[model samples]
Each structure stands twice: as C-alpha cells, then as structure tokens.
Target: MSPYHHGDLRRAILTAALDVIATDGPSALSLRDLARRAGVSHAAPAHHFRDRTGLLTAIAAEGHGLLAEELAGTTDLRDAGARYVRFARQHPAHFQVMFTPNLLHTDDLELTTARALSGAALTDALAPTAPTGDDPHARYARLAVWSLAHGFATLLLGHNLDRLLGDEDPEEVLRELPMFLLPPA
Candidate 1:
C-alpha cells in the first residue's frame, strides 16, 4: 500500500474498516487490510484502534449512537421500528458488528454508554403505547417490540425475506407489522 498522510487518520481507518466489513463481512476484516485500504502504514490502524476487537468496539459504539439518534427523533413506536430497520439498511456494516457482542469489548465504556442510550430511546418510543402500572407487562412489551424490529431487520439484511417481501419495501412492512399484533380499533 502506498503510504499517505490523512488529516483524520482515525476516521479514515474507521471508514476503510467499515467498507471492508460491508464488502466481505467482519470475519475478513484485518488491520493490515484496513491500513492498505486507507493508504497508510500497517501500524496506522493499530495506533487508532489498538486491535481488531477495539476497532469493532468503536464501530459498535458508533452504531448504537446512530441508532439512538434515529430512534430519539420519533415518539411513535411504529415509526421508531421503521427507523430501526432503515438504520440497519443504511449502516449494514455497523449493524452487523453492533449486535454481535462476541466480537466487541462488551465492557468498553463507550460501547456500554452508547448501547444504554439506544435502549433508552427504544424504551421511550414504547412509552406512548405501553400499558400503565404493570412493570412486568411493560418490560415484556418492550422486549417484544425490540425483538420484532430487530428480527425483521436481521432477516431483511440477510435477504431471508426475499420470498415473503418480493418487491415490497421492508421499512414499510415493519411500519405495518403492528397491525398484525393488535386487534382492530
């Protein structure tokens, strides 16, 4: 790889890493490959991320933060769910790494905090539709909502929904998914 100077080496390395993950899956990501993609020395990525796990941790943290921002924009649970799917579509690399905690430093403070913020945004989105006073049911409802959205996104990303969805937009499908769970008003 031709050595080059990047005004923002950290961001450049992260961007290159994400591209690699997106194109080849995280299993194929290597610091040396990222450095080459970034047109920097092999040691350049190590200086920014320390190791592969550290790089994945940064991606996970950034993914959660982006998801939090997306979810926080809307109070409607359905809208939030749609946004979740959209975020996955927009940042498949980050989405892939974010959910696979085994690839990350789970105790990393940045990852933990970003994850908590995303969880809070999801919970807040559920607040409008959540039943009153029953914490157990509320908790269950939150899990259900999260599972539905997350499952749908995962399936869509993996192209597992091709037969079922055909030409339909996945985000639109997710926005309409709640209708199947609730009876007519």
Candidate 2:
C-alpha cells in the first residue's frame, strides 16, 4: 500500500469499475480506461487490483455485502424473499454482476468473504421461520424460497415482467411467492 497516493486505491478502483461496468457491459472495462476515468495514472489501478478480474471480483464482493445488509434489515423472515427482489431492483449495478460467476474471480478474499456472509445471513434470516419438517423437506423449502426470489428478480430484470403484466404491478407477484411456496395449511 503506497501511502504517497493510492492509499486506498483498491476500493477507489473497484468503485470506478462498478460504475463503468454498470453503465456499459463488462467488456468495456479496462485498467487504463479506469485510471483515466478515475484521474489516476494508468498504472495506479494495477497497484491495487492487478487486473480487470480483481476489480470485478471486488465489486461482486461489495454486492454481497450490500445484499447481506439488506437481508439483515428485514424484520420478517417470511417476507425476505420479496425483499430480495426489491434489493436487486434498488441496486441494479451490484445486482447485475453478482450472480455472474464468469464476470468475477472467485479466488479473491473479499469476494469469498462477501459470498460467505450473504449465505450466512440467508440461513440466519430463515432459521426462525423455516417450516418444521424432516431434512429433505427443510432443504427443499429453503431452496424454494431462494429460487422463487432469484427467479422473480431475473424476470424483472429481463423485462419479462413488463410483457406479462402490461401496466399492472408485478411486485405483488414477488411478495406472494413465499405464501405460494410454503406448505399448504
């Protein structure tokens, strides 16, 4: 860590990269371009991120942290699935790159930590509310919640919701997923 400048260049570069990747696609990102945009020397980013992969990985990690925070804020585990979709909608930049493994280098420490915490938060968030059942039943129930939220977000992002809903609100569909998936009363 050079103290003269770039004291925290790693974070700066990641922020800049996420912005660029969000506005344009990942293919449009590059160290030189990021440095130029960040007003640092072209070599500055390398000192922190090494390459595009490192920067992308950092962004993904950051995304997971944000998701964890969002999930942590939910008071009702039963409603968290809908909140997950809302999180993705609000943080489209982070949300877009987070699920794409090809876009990130998984070996990065920050990325790994971020992913782990998100998983932990999910388990914590659901533990109290998960239906009482046998092992397979519990696993399937958890998967159903995760998948429904994930699928709804993917559809909303793909604009499929628009084609399906016309002018009506599709968010309601997201909110109702848990009710539909939970074992019938």
Candidate 3:
C-alpha cells in the first residue's frame, strides 16, 4: 500500500477500520486491509494500534465516549433510552465492537475509563426515577432500566424488531415500552 503522508494517520486508520466493520463486521477487520483502505503502509496501523486487539480496544473506548456524550444531560430515563437506541442505530460499527468484550482488551485503561463514564451517564439518567436507596432493590431497578434499553437496542440492530415493530417508530415504541412493562411507582 502507498504510505499516507498527510492528515491524522491514527484517525484515518480508525475511520477505515470502522468502515470495514460497518460493512463486513469486526471479524473481517485487519491491519493490512485497513492500511490499504487508508492508503497507508500495512505497518501504519500496527504503529498506532499495536495489534488488532488494540484497534478494537480503541474502537470500544471511542464508542463508550460517544455513548456518554449522547446520554449526557438527560434526566429522563426514557429519553436516555431513546438516545441509546439512536446512538446504536447511528454508530452500529462502534456499538458492535463496544459490546463484544472478546474483541477488546477489557483491561485497557482508556476502555475502562470510557466505559465508566458511559455507565455513570446511564446511572445518572435513571437516578431521577429510580427508587431512592442504596439497597438491592435500587440496584435492581438500575439494572432493569439498563437491560430494557440495551435489549431494545440490540434487537433493533439485529433486525429482530422488524417483525414486531413493522412500520412503527422504534424510538416511539421504546419511549412507551416502560409504561406497559413496569409498574408505576
């Protein structure tokens, strides 16, 4: 591959990797292929990312950071849930890599910090409506909220919701789902 001399090589490689992942799944990603796509030498990606695991870790961290941004400043759990769904739909490649722990270096500091930020954002969103207590019930409530949003996003991304949501807006469905699934507090 021709060496890429200008612009941000790291960002270019990451963008190329995301495009590959978006079209062919993460399993299809490779430094050589990304380098070719970025018009850089095969060693370029390795120089910036070290290896495939490192690349995936970077993607995961970036995804969490993006998710945190999307979930930020939202006090309503339903709104946060809808934002989560929108983020998944908008960045399916990052979403896919972020959730697949096997593809990441789970202990990477950046990944851990980004994940913590996103987790905190989600927890904060649920704090307003969640039962006030440092008890198992409160923790379960948080888990349930996360599960509902995550499950819905997963189903939507997998296209499994098409049959159930046919011609209906998924975000609208999500906004109304908790009303039927959870008991009023």
Which candidate ranks first by TM-score, i.e. highest? 3
What are the TM-scores, per candidate, against the unseen true structure? 0.92, 0.82, 0.93
Clash pairs, candidate 3, are none
Worst 10 residues of 2 by lDDT: 176-185
lDDT of 2 by residue, 112-132 (tens): 999998877776666766755
lDDT of 3 by residue, 1-185 (tens): 46748488899888988998998999999898888878888787887898999999999999999999999998587788889999999999999999999999999999999999998998788787777668787788888878898899999999999999999989878888855434333
Report how far off residue 39 is in candidate 2 (Å).
Answer: 0.8
The candidate 1 region of ten consecutive residues with least summed lDDT is: 176-185
**What would the per-residue lDDT of candidate 1 be over residues 1-185, giving only the tens digit for each residue?**
54656788889888988898898999998998888778889887887797999999999999999999989867477788889999999999999999998999999999999999998898888877776456898888888878888999999989999999999989888877655432222
lDDT of each: 0.87, 0.74, 0.87
Model 1 TM-score (2 dp)? 0.92
Cα distance off (Å), candidate 1, residue 1:
6.6
From the highest TM-score down, the ranking of the candidates is 3, 1, 2
**Model 3 ranges with Cα > 4 A deviation:** 1-4, 178-185
Off by over 4 Å in 2: 1-8, 131-134, 166-170, 182-185
